[model samples]
Target: MDWLTFAAFALFAVFSGLGAAFLLRRFGGSSGQWLDALDRLERRIREDLVANREEASKAARGLREEVVGTLKDMAVLQKSTLDGFGAQMGRLTNSLEQRLDAFARQIGDLTKANEMRQEALRATVELRLGQLQEDNAAKLEQMRQTVDEKLQGTLEKRLGESFKLVSERLEQVQKGLGEMQSLANGVGDLKKVLTNVKTRGTWGEVQLGNLLEQILTPDQFMANVACREGSSDRVEYVIRLPGRGEGDGEVWLPIDAKFPREDYERLVEAAERADPEAVEASARALEARIKQSAKDIAGKYVHPPRTTDFAILFLPTEGLYAEVLRRPGLMDALQRDYRVNLCGPTTLGALLNSLQMGFRTLAIQQRSSEVWEILGAVKSEFGKYGEVLDKVQKKLVEASNSIEDISVRRRAIDRKLRGVAALPNDGAKAVLELIEPADVEPD
Candidate 1:
């Protein structure tokens, strides 16, 4: 397994080969020996005898060194073996002493085991006492568990009663709250109606304004502005229509709020009847009122002084809107004179949203124009600042050049100060400080 073992085996093989080689030299054919001799018959053989002898001597020295090394190794092994024997003898004496120690320990162990047996007996008695104590503790624990269970049952009964009472009270409170909520909703509806009534104009104006406000938008049209110069019948509002008219002027729109409620109620009552003649008469009466109101609005809002392409009659009530639409030839007659736009609450909301978007867009454009002007002014100011900085930089360079030589400037300043010292003190004369003396020299 080791290199030394392999080397020993190899050396033994070499010795055996040497023995075989000697035997072969004695008994082998003479021709083989002659061939071996002829192999050394080169031209350089005789010329390099000293070199060959030196090489042989080196090989002999290496063999001798190997033999000496092997002998030295054998001596080292012998000395180590002797030292190992002495150490083994000393270890044997120590082992014999340890055995004597074991004999004494056996005596101590027997004495200790006897004491341990007595202790074990005492521990057995203590273990029985502990068992008795555990039993007593277990009995006490059982009594405590029984008491805890009884108390838990009593507390659970009280808690369950309290929970049931609280649940009943909560149900009652929820019911009361629901009733209050319903009452609040009714009050809110009433308040909304009153608010609508209060926000509109006078009794007639309030009704009309409320109807129109609910049915039309404020931004798309102007309300209650003068119709014509010195005119008593002021049109309610003028609507600025989308398309431009002739001469690129804005197209006009008419918006009215007046409605006849007496005729409307009569018609509704007549509509529920089976009498055709009565129904026709009531329809005629309602048509007459519609025509009269339309004619009045047209004269006030769609006339020569208040001319408009289209007009609107704001009908706040849904029933009124349906009734107007159902009237045959009524819309045609009104539209023939002036384009009439009839709107209810829903369409009115859409119109208001459109007007809001238009206003917002206009304001944004105006604001952007102002911002552009401000930015342009800022750019101009920044350009002026750049020019001023360049001027300042030139002045700074001139100043720096004037004081380039610090020692010369200091001597010149001292000479000038010595000349100024000869001047009279003029603390009370401010004029002398402002004007230099005419006779002053450059020295």
Candidate 2:
């Protein structure tokens, strides 16, 4: 039931009770039960109201306390959460600031290093270019100097040679007549000396000795050397010839000088006078004398196995040599019967040159033998050197392998260093992006 209906019922009950009591009191003045009953009912109502009021007040106070306590707890919890969140934000802020500082430092360092390197590279390039320019300038200067010197030297040498040739020709022309007069006087004196047999022989010997001295060293020729074993048959000159082969003893080659200038002069005079009988007699006499001289030289000097099988008959003058050769069968008879070979100054000179060449060839052969011995020793040592080089090469290869291993490790380390270097920049950028500017304010 509704509270208003209940209240209206109670009020009607109270009024009914009072009216009943009043009527009773008026009807019967001595009826006290109805008054008592009304009082009790009123008292009961009042007590009930009091009790309800007290209970409602107590319940409202309890509800208010509970609400206040809940609000206090909520406030504490929110404060704690906010405090923890603020601490975390502060730590993040400090860390981000530190990372950003490090990143900035790295960037600054990299920029400074780049600038320094660029400056150094530019300086080095300039220095190298300057040096190259200087070197080129020096080389050009040197080449110019060398060319100038060579050209000057060549010109001086050619000029000197040309002047010397011209001077020699002029001097020769000036001396021609004087030289011809001197030669004619000399021929007259030579003819007078030849008139004495002993003086002629001495002159021939001196001429032969001079020729020998021109062609050979002192040790190679001896003058007035005796050749015959029993008799004193001394020769004008004897040349010591080298053996045909190694270890063979040297052989002596005897030479005899026969001028026979008088016979030659008689032949020449007869021929110039155009006297046929005198020319024939003179030529025959010259031929016979030369043949006899060859025989005498062979018999005295041509001793085989000691001296050479043939001896030389030297005609000091070319004209005399030519006359001897012009005699029919004279040279052949001398070679076959007397074992003598004829030679003039020109022919003897050619023979001496050939002998010098032979000596040179023999010396070269001896040097070659020594070189072969040295080469053999060098070859033996070279084989050992080759073995040592092989060992060294093997060691070098081993060292190279070790170096290769170290290089690989170095490469890996370099990569790690590069990765570490990049971390400050990239990580700091990410951290900076996460932090907002407002979040850094103090609560």
Candidate 3:
């Protein structure tokens, strides 16, 4: 039997046993057997109570222990979380220190570079002094030769011959020294130029960069670039212009300061007496150099990111600008070699204008797309408004019916009236007669 039913029966037996025992004591030994059976039932009921209590106590204890264990587990989990956070924090700190150290090392490198620049400047000064000495020696030797020629004889020839051998050896020594001095001076000047470039705000270079940036679409090759090709053995501004988009070819444009400043300055000082042939010769040399430069850049810069192109040679200075344009057969030669064209400021400006036009066209196309998208959005919203209008029409019909329903309206009024005060029987009956209930409703 279930414990509840068993308990009920036990209770009844115990009560009966007590009554039988009382009856046995009051009446006769015939009731004494019933009393003994009732006593046995009482003992069995006690056993059931004790067993149920023990089981119930065990379950309660187990539940209480489980609650305590969960609390302890929570405490351990919290500690692990904190430890993991601490480890992460330590790792983050280490990474930050490593980055800081790298920055420090870069700073140190800059400092060393500055020192090397100072040393280079000192070397350049020594080289200039050496050049002055060599020049003075050469002039002295030339004067001595003139004197020997004027008084050519036994003593003179003997002295000149003796001096000539020594002069040749001295010239060789001076030439070697000149080479050493030139190397040193070149390195120093380069260092000074680098320092100036680093500190002088790069205004001229920036202007050139801006010009190129305006001229070329980003996809155009090296229009704003500065780097050396292996063959050129020099670094300068390089550009690549496309050829007539056909027959597998393109054009390269190399631009930099190529005017010989010293010669051009001399020419300006003597404009009336300037030797045109001299200037022309200088121009010829420039053309040769530009041709050389274009050819060199073609090997690397003008190569299709991996192929070749027809190229341009840009001379930023106008001193010899006309000379370059006037080179006979120059254009034909450039074309023959698959490296072509030479552009000056005027042509460069026109190129930039074309690029700007292209960008403007692209921008207009993008705006047209955006306008189409906006129209589509407006059309979609119009459809949503159509759905809202339909829903509003349904609601308006419902409102009309609700207002027409006298029974529903009166029910609401009655509720509101009853909320404020209790209705008297007469008033309540009169109010109730105001409307009739509907005979129909939705099932």
Tens-place lDDT per residue, model 3, 308-377, is 3444555445545565667787767766774656656667667667756755675686489788999999
Task: Evaluate model 2: give its lDDT.
Answer: 0.85
TM-score of each candidate?
0.34, 0.46, 0.32
Q: Model 1: which ten-residue window has the lowest total lDDT?
A: 197-206
Error of 1 at 434 (Å): 54
Model 3: clashing residue pairs?
Answer: 250-310, 251-310, 252-310, 252-311, 252-312, 304-307, 311-340
Instruction: Name the lDDT value of residue 21 in candidate 3.
Output: 66
Against the unseen true structure, what C-alpha lDDT does each candidate score? 0.68, 0.85, 0.64
> Which stretches in model 2 have alpha-carbon errors above 4 Å?
1-207, 214-217, 242-248, 359-372, 391-443
Number of backbone collisions per candidate: 1, 0, 7
Write candidate 1's Cα lDDT for 1-443 as tens digits: 44444554565556555655665677576766645544443223443554655666787789889999999999999999999999999999999999989988998999899899989989998999999899989988998899899889988988999999999989989988998898899788755553553322123344555544664466556667655567777666666544433345444556666455666667788778766777677778877776777777766666542456556666656676677778788888767854566655555556656656765675686589788999999999999999999999999998887877776889988988885644445653464555456757768
TM-score of 2: 0.46
- Each model's Cα RMSD: 25.6, 45.4, 57.1
Error of 2 at 229 (Å): 2.7
lDDT (10s digit) by residue, model 2, range 77-134: 9999999999999999999999999999999999999999999999999999999999
- Name the best candidate (by TM-score): 2
